[model samples]
Target: MNNQDIKAKETTKDSKYIQQHLANERTFLAWIRTAISIIGVGFLVTNLHFTMRSTLSPLGNQLATLIGLVSVAVGIVTIILSAAVYVKKIKDINNQTFRPPVISMIFLGVFIIIISLIFGAYFFII
Candidate 1:
């Protein structure tokens, strides 16, 4: 009904903005979880490959083991970078200075799904 009333309404909207920012934080946490899963899978692959090769094919086993290790290392790096970016994004959002250029999450989701499908098929099928 007055200037004070209008200001209160504006603050409420800003609070909603903050809520969305919290949602972003939750989403980033989810990303971290996915990263952990990815890293775990990489380790699992390395171990499983090594165990299967415990009795044969020394050279090929070593190569495959190295590749699995590399996958784990890459997963760690990816997670570290993602965390850094998430913190930067949160800062930008708090300053009200960033609008995402694209739905980065869409790509992320797609990649995760694809990985899941590939791994699932590999394990559950022949």
Candidate 2:
């Protein structure tokens, strides 16, 4: 084989690496699905505010709308950030670079905490 062909073969990853890359793609897609679900929940909450106007106080409706908007914003941010992170990870993997998972983990944890607090406010304060 020519040097060019040999070099190309050398750079190509094996089946294991390909599997890992596929797994990463699956994970990214899962995050996208989660974001869509969050958006759907947000829309539902906003719609509820209008449908139950007679039963809900003005403040409660406003709170619900705010929560819904925030949820949607968060979901959009998550999708953007997650896609960026996924791309970075894939590049790192291909380059054989070590990447710490701390950042993504912390972001997800904080996101969950914030969502939990919003749920608490919705149930208790609203």
Model 2 C-alpha lDDT per residue in residues 28-83, reported as the tens digit of each score: 99999999999998899778767865678777777788879988998999799889
- lDDT string for model 1 (1-126, tens) is 999888767755346478767877787788678677767877786677667744546554554555467667757877887788777877777678878746766877786787666555444432
After TM-score superposition, the amount by which residue 54's alpha carbon in candidate 2 deviates from its true location, in angstroms, is 1.9
Q: What is the lDDT of residue 34 in candidate 1?
A: 69
In angstroms, the error of model 1 at 73 is 1.6
Q: Candidate 1: worst 10 consecutive residues by lDDT?
A: 117-126
- Top-TM-score structure, candidate number: 2
- TM for every model, in the order presented, reads 0.58, 0.81
In candidate 2, which residue pairs get closer than 3 Å at backbone N, Cα or C atoms, i.e. clash? none
